[model samples]
Target: MGNITKRGSRELEGDGAPSLVEGPRTELHTELYAAIMREDCTAIQVLLSSHPINQPVTILANSTSHRFLSTQTQSIMPIHLAAKYCKAQSLLCLLEHGADPEIRDSRGLTTLHLMLLHWPISSTMWTKLGNRTQRTLTNTQKDAVRCLLILCEHGAHVNARVDDSNKYSPLHLAVAHGTSPVLSILAQKGAQVNATNESSMTPLHMAAELLNQEMTEMLIACGANVNCAVSCTGSTALKLAVCTASSKAGRLLAAGVSCIHSLLTHGATVNAQDHEGQTAIHEACFGGREAIINLLLEYEANVNILTRNGESPIYMYLQHSSNLRDRVLLTKLLYCSYPLRLTNNQGALPAGIMLPEFHLLRETLIKLSQKLLSLEDICKRVISNIYGEKHKHHLKQLLPVKMWNSIYCHDSAYLLK
Candidate 1:
């Protein structure tokens, strides 16, 4: 400590505390701040031994950054600043010198929260968006992980939550922004995998919403509830995954698919209905995702599942008919008893999806809707439903291979074309 001008000429008071006779109340902690920043453990111990702990000080934030002149200074605890900047040695010193790791700053974020907020995210989070950035855990990230472990070791509450409106737990922040090492540290330290934020969104839900397969799998392995629904929409992790998949393509689309598979394999309800009575299959169909539709169907997703307006999955599928160049797929869905004659709350029928140029297609659909199902098709529907009722998601595993092939691999293209 180079005798910071404000801390000059410290004299011993009657109580033996360092009576600073020269500093403003606002800048009294300048020397202590310099000591912490310099990672001077001896000086830190000396200052903390005499001065009051948890002193709130105002200092310019982000002042050294090239982007701005200087940000408005806000009062923050020194422990938070240490953790936020990933001052690993300084943070350990602070905690060892009696700093409360669980104490919240003005933003209601604890030391663990700020540590996670500053940790570097890996490429795994952006691989879904087609970013192929090479992932090399930098020295800074290692320091962040070490800081997290130190905080945890020093009795930082792993489950402590932010007091703000988001009500984010340390685990939520970890999953939202932190790397795997940080998340692992928090999880091993007893962070709650199923903890929900103010939106009733769990860590797994946030992972699914971002279509982060790695985080999704990690949360599942930690015993995350695969079916936790959002408070406002009753949207489960599966539904949210379907929605994300519908909007993305290429690598991102595959990432969403992987996340959905992880959730479903971990026992997510394939047929979970939302507040509007929309299931995952309905969303898949509405998005015109052929692969997604097939996956949902194989998991025994109900093709005839209805929405609040009485619209079925096939109806949603037809809503994007331009994408369905293969009319045979429609015929196959009809064979699966997609309820071609069902009407919605507005009296919209399956044929309503047909365009004027598609006259032959419309006529074909109306005639098909009027005709009774052939015995083979009816048997396919009846037997499949019966088997699904008994086997549920395990239908493929339990059913005989030949029988499963016979039911799912019918040659309907020739009939439609």
Candidate 2:
């Protein structure tokens, strides 16, 4: 007992937590890991009291499961395991017993990374969509925050990339998991707001992809570049928001709209194109959400712009039969005045792909396409294309209030009237 006491006291004599030292992957390390997985704090204390604290505990990396999912890997320390499983008491016990928070697993994820990875979600609120158990997330969130503070206080690198391959910082993890409080804490502690992941995507891109307005605004306030392009697709945050909005449930439409508005108000280019020459309007049309399409148009998104594949917004709208019932959106696109006879890469005309049920819509578009343009329609198209980039102050003076409000409000009815 005396020898064990002396060893325990001696292990804590360093300036901080002990550094990881290479050692045998013995059964003793396995027993220690089993104790951690079981959250057996007493056994953990005994294991540390009996053996050296810095000996390596080898766990296999499971990177092949999925690119987005992280698995426990070799080089993981006891503190990382405890944090990952949300065993706060065991984690505290390990920390007090000299486990280092700065130690990284084989993938270079720190204790901080593991904490964010396993942070609790509000099962009662947002869990209906998943299999998360119904439990109050209040205590779980508090515990997560406590662990985060402990790691930071013990010199965990907040901005450290999780792995050399992905370059995902702790902030990126927080954003990906939708942990807002942890995100704020990381931002307050100087996590790089514009730090890019392997795809050259900033945290703002993730927030926009999730269509989370609150997270998007927070990242913007933290100075995340609203218009940063992903190197792989050359997609900006605004373009990502539109693409993401198309796939979400209809109940989340308002949140998607709010996110788009936030990106636009932050000076995101409404007409910004991706590598394929598709704008946010193109994504909105493809998504088939009437509200988002209206919102993008209200922001003066150019509807007539063609993709590299030669698909215009009108062509994109007609390509998706799901959008057939959205008469207002169809009307808006028909009025945008692009030549409908142009062929896409598939050689499909804007009018060629119409379903049988959309006969009335097809008739209306044909009549409008053939009718001579009114003086007002000609002025509207010219203003939309020519003065699209002019400052609002000049446009406010140049155009009549009704016409200006119709364009700015995306009121297709008023504009068409």
Candidate 3:
């Protein structure tokens, strides 16, 4: 009922007020944009089917008060407006009236890509932080989920990559946002499970790096490649899980074990090296997670695998040998066939890298590195390597479920020959 104002299409009146041009078609374009944003579905139906303006017409991005865009989008269409504001019924009306589902904004984001950027991160955080407000968001989440399904069902491309520097796919956004429901919808729509960003990292790699066990397993079940190398770094999902837990203090202690087990069972190449040639075991030792180290060994991880600098996992462990809160892990790595003559490219042996302040501690580790494993240690290592390498996925099938933890993933390292 009031005078509509669109940027480019508007002209200044004599009193210095900006107002819409007095043309029939331009007026119709202005009305259509407003109707879609307010979700006036009936009004939108009448405007589109009867107006002289084109159904796929767009307005300037600044026309709205809330801008969800990162960079400037030259122009955004009715579908973009409806999606950004979450006007589901209005969006469906426009789509039914022949709106282009795949039309992209100047930033090259389709309707689906644009909507996910504004996803309910607060809702996900509440659930993670154990707040009671998540129940209140249930109906709202259902609406958002339905919006995504409607977009996908109307032919929005699930694998369409953003034309920005990040080059994120819908799957990448879903994982980064940590919403499994939205991720599941995209996957069901045939989103590429292994789609890479500009960094060459897959959704599975992101899941692993985030240390989300449920997401990691979901991607694996959806056929994510567990062994896929990351962007330029050549780090796989197994290494990512351990590396992220490296130094977050005790908050992240053993947090990656569940994700590591999922990756291993789904076929993670345990000994696969990064660009620097460090294996998951090398990282696990550096992080000082005995549980993760033991889990890797259960999968026949080669502790002696060298880095590009020729450093072994034992050398990495001694970096904190004196500060070790528990000696059981250091002892386990020693018994797991750590090479006695270990040396990096610099010709420094594993025991030589210990902190200088702990001279007595360094000498003790140097002596221990050269000693033979006790019979109990030897038998444990041999049986663990054999069972894990041969029957990785059937841990419960071959042993008592109770002993599974003690033998393969715990400090006990118990095993049978």
Candidate 4:
């Protein structure tokens, strides 16, 4: 074995059982990792200079063998390590030294993928950095972006799918993680905006799920499929927006409306239903958004359309809402000016079903029934006035006496009395 040196200063362990300098090599890699994490480039250079490039130190896992033996034994390359630690300058240094961007650990994630996967950290840290410090990218983000750019420039497959999990691509990761900077870089590098994972979800679906309005708009601008349904459940980005129970539903709804306009302009069907036979109207109703429901109706959504379970928008609202004021408002909006006797597939009229907390709705139905009866009485009176007493007698036999008395009684209000 060759003689070992510390900081290239003194030769040690000539006739050695184990070289005394071996301890320094182990300590050097650890120091390098620490320096990278702290963004201390100078300390990293000093550490790197102390060791020969071919001297094979177990920098990552501290194993004596340089070659990985087991799947768990595989150590991340320095660039992979830098990306994992969010050390941009260290990543750049490794990339500069020709570290493999395509290196995969036990998880098979590329350095870029790892950076994208660790996105929440980037978002939280960068947001704080952006707010507290300069408006420019933080030290951490600058390093991350630089690493990502290097990978992209080196043909790192901007649209590479993550290992065997087709649920995410690099674009999906970017959008899902809220890594806007990384997303921009990938988009500019020709990543497919409408690419579906195993779930058949485009990047837009991820942005909608995260309720990231800015990311949704960015993906839309890049031509993501607004109405593309995920194969897992056949949910579109708009449908997913309303499905979430989060308070961001309002913002998501607004985004969905914008996406709907774009989709409709591009020939998307407003009444398109999912695998469960639930339309965007069904989603809006379940979400209890009167504004969203109105928007869908204005787009000519089939308001009375039923799901596979035989529930219409009104039924969905009744099932999902416990508030009386909301039920009353929704009932009036859905049933006003429409005939209730229109039978659905199950032979039940839309207005006949008793909704919970909607006593006002039941009262409204009774009122409508009375109005129909009054119209019949007026038709009979008109016949008596124009045709003759004989025709009036014939009409009187056809009409129910109770209905007639209720309409024409002028004194005592006999039914009430």
TM-scores for every predicted model: 0.79, 0.70, 0.76, 0.65
For residues 148-174, what per-residue lDDT tens digits would candidate 2 score against the true structure? 877777677898887777788898888
Better of 2 and 3 by TM-score: 3
Question: Comparing candidate 1 with candidate 2, which one achieves the higher TM-score?
Answer: 1
Per-residue lDDT value at 415 in model 3: 15
Full-model lDDT, candidate 1: 0.73
Q: Any residue pairs clashing in model 1, and if so which?
A: none
CA RMSD, predictions in order: 7.2, 9.5, 6.5, 12.7
TM-score of 3: 0.76
lDDT of residue 231 for candidate 2 = 89
Best by lDDT: 2
For model 4, the stretches where C-alpha displacement exceeds 4 angstroms are 1-24, 34-75, 85-89, 119-139, 164-166, 245-269, 321-324, 336-417
Which should have the higher TM-score, number 3 or number 4?
3
Candidate 3: tens digits of C-alpha lDDT, residues 1-417:
333444344433433443434446545665676777677888887886666322344333234432332222233577877787677887788778777778887778888887887765446656464445676566567667777888988988999988889899999988887776777778878999999999899999999998888899998888788899986999998898888866554555555677778888889998999999999988888777677777787788887688899888877876665425455665566556534434578977555345565566556656755677766656656666666545745865777776565556655333110
The alpha-carbon lDDT assigned to residue 331 of candidate 2 equals 63
lDDT of 4 at 310: 69
Residue-level lDDT of model 1, residues 1-417, one tens digit each, is 122243233322333443443434434456566666667778878777656667654433333322312254455677886887777898988887788888887688888887888876554445544422433435556777788889889999999989999999887887777355666667788988898899989988888888888888888888788988888999999999898898888888888888888888889999999999999988887887767776777677888878898888877877775645657557666666534654678977655356676667666666766777667777777666555433544667867887777676667664344
For the record, the alpha-carbon RMSD of candidate 4 to the native fold, in angstroms, is 12.7
In candidate 3, which residue pairs clash?
none
| Candidate 4 lDDT over residue span 238-353, tens digit each | 66765652223566657665655444454446677889888877777666666666556555666557678666666565444342345445544333222222233585544433
lDDT of each: 0.73, 0.73, 0.72, 0.59
- Candidate number of the best TM-score: 1
After TM-score superposition, the amount by which residue 282's alpha carbon in candidate 4 deviates from its true location, in angstroms, is 1.0
